[model samples]
Target: MKVAVFSDVQAVLPALEAVIEHIEAWHPDMVVMAGDLVNRGPDSGGCLALFDAMRREQGWLPVYGNHEVWVLRCGEEAPASEGERDIRRFTDLAWQQVADQAERLHGWPDHLCLHPPDADAWLHVTHGTMAGNRDGITPGRSDESLAGKLPQGVALFVSGHTHRAHQRRTQGMDVVNVGSVGSPFDGDVRGSYGRFTWRGGRWHTELVRFPYDRERAARDFETSGFLDQGGPLARIVYLEWERAELLIAGWRERYQDAVLRGEITLESSVERYLRTIT
Candidate 1:
């Protein structure tokens, strides 16, 4: 079986375009989008359009990320303060524009399962762990710790959230993080995707990195008013176009203190962090 895996292509059409081209060339049997498809960048509507086109051309298996849930919550009807209303309005416009194709999974487990034909091993996919939980498996964590948390029957675990690409084999199982198709936290700014092949009792994993028109993506941010937001989004789209790592590291450093001191809840901290950046 050949599987193409990607995640965090948040409204960057050029990066998404490169990923689609690679998928066409590879012609994998299955394509998995680990999560965080929208609700951060200025081009949320454009992102949905791209997703719809991809689903029409090639079926997709999508998992839910924290951003997806945030969008949905923002779109729902609720009383709001003036500032909240402004944010919700933008969010509603974004959601209404692409709600049809933004497939929602209740949780991470909903996105993955065994490939039926081969029952010897199981395939598990997720956008990291469930919402509001940060202790999920990511590249920074040890393999033994990760294996202990995973469900039984999971021989191959694939995920994307930390935006880092990694492949590790432990106790006869393969654990892989597909990295980001658009918003990568690694020092490398180039978009990344992964291809996995299981043949003749062996598994092969390859990471594919490609360049996209960053200038165009940046221009969209300017047009979308994200630049004026004066938060993480500005840093990500304009200042830190070279890499997402510095911004992510700064956020982790800032929030870890709040979380440890119990000054803020995890949910609130995550919301604050994402709102600042997205």
Candidate 2:
């Protein structure tokens, strides 16, 4: 079995288009979008539209990201103030943009037992680790932490949400993070993705990076009206494209301080950081 895995599109339509073009060229049996399909970038509608088009054309599998959760829950119960209404409007446009082909999963099962007969073993996919949500797994974490959560019988575990491309092996499983496709934070603006091959009872994972038009993506943000949110979002996006380690390190420092002070919960901290940056 050959599969393509990616995540964190975050409204960069050109980047998304580039990735989809690559996926089509590769013709993988399955495509997995690890999460964060919308929010952050100026073009939420464009992001959702790209996903919807992919779903119709390729029938890809999508895992839920925290950003997706936020967009979905926006304005669901609370009354919309003017400011909230604007936010909700953007979110609704994003949701309606992808309504044609949005696939949601509560959690990834331990194993994907059903695969083509040619496939060597069952395939597994998750947005992050099996133990927790988006924050549970990251490229900087120790291998021991990963080895502990990986299932015993699965041949391969594929994930994203950390926005970094990495491949690690523990026990009998090949653990891979396909990295981000649209909104890469892997110290490079180039989009990152992964290709997996199952052969002879072993899985081979390869991290692939391709150059996309970051200037164009940035331009999309500017034209889409998110530039007015202040320069931080745009700066963060640009810096994230250039150097993800720095961004992650800065976030880690702030998050640790907030945690030590008990000033905010983890979820709230994450949300706050995202709002500030994106």
Candidate 3:
């Protein structure tokens, strides 16, 4: 049996399309979305619909990621103050545009277990880890640290959220990080995914990169209302795509506290950070 795992598509339609075309060529028996499949890019609604269609027509499975949780929380929670109400209103509008079927993200299980025929061990799949979705399994973590991220007795653990693909073995278990199909934190811009094959009573894995129309994806950020309506942080989000690298993390470290405390406006912080980069 052949299996394909995709994660962090993050609502870039072209990237997901490229991934789908590649998966079709490979023709895996099972296709899984490791999650964060929506938000943080242009056309979150379109992405959600596309995945939903794939699941309905072709049996792709989805597991929850923290971004899914974030979008839901953004849409569902009531604001606590007038300033927060404005933030809530802004977030809610964006959320509503894509969240008509938002429950689908909420409905997903945190992880999945694949039991191939006549195989004694199962392959476990998740957006992050059994531990949680944030700060998911990293490739270079120490054996002890990595072991803490997994559940014992599983033959294989598959995850994403780091946006850097890798495969390693530790504590007698195989671990694979499928990386990002979109919005990769790694410097490479190409879409990435994982392929797994079950043969001869064991599993083999590979991380593959699928090149997509990233130019079109970058343009979509402005045209699709994501950056315009996705709020102040959207600026940094678009910058991440433009550079094909991470920057908001450093920005966040410097300004998150100030932004939260009302000392610095989010727009000011984002602009301040961008000037240094630009």
Each candidate structure's count of clashing pairs: 2, 0, 0
Model 3 misplacement above 4 A: 81-94
Please give the RMSD of candidate 1 to the true structure: 5.5
- Residue 20 error for model 1, in Å? 0.6
Task: Give candidate 1's TM-score.
Answer: 0.77
As a whole number from 0 to 100, the lDDT of residue 177 in candidate 2 is 80
TM-score of each: 0.77, 0.75, 0.93
Residue-level lDDT for 42 in candidate 1? 64
Local distance difference test, candidate 3: 0.82
**lDDT of residue 158 for candidate 2:** 79
Model 1 residue 1 distance off true place after TM-score fit, in angstroms? 1.8
Tens digits of lDDT, candidate 2, 1-278: 78888877877778788888887888888887777777766676666766766766768777777777766665244524433343344455555545554443234332233344765566677676777446545667887666567665677787777877788776677778887877666567688888887667666778888878777876776667655442332444445654544364565677745544566554455467777765
Candidate 1 overall Cα lDDT vs. reference? 0.67
Candidate 1, residue 110: CA error in Å?
Answer: 3.8
> lDDT of each model, Cα atoms only?
0.67, 0.66, 0.82
Stretches of candidate 1 exceeding 4 Å from the true structure:
77-109, 116-119, 130-136, 229-233, 236-242, 246-278
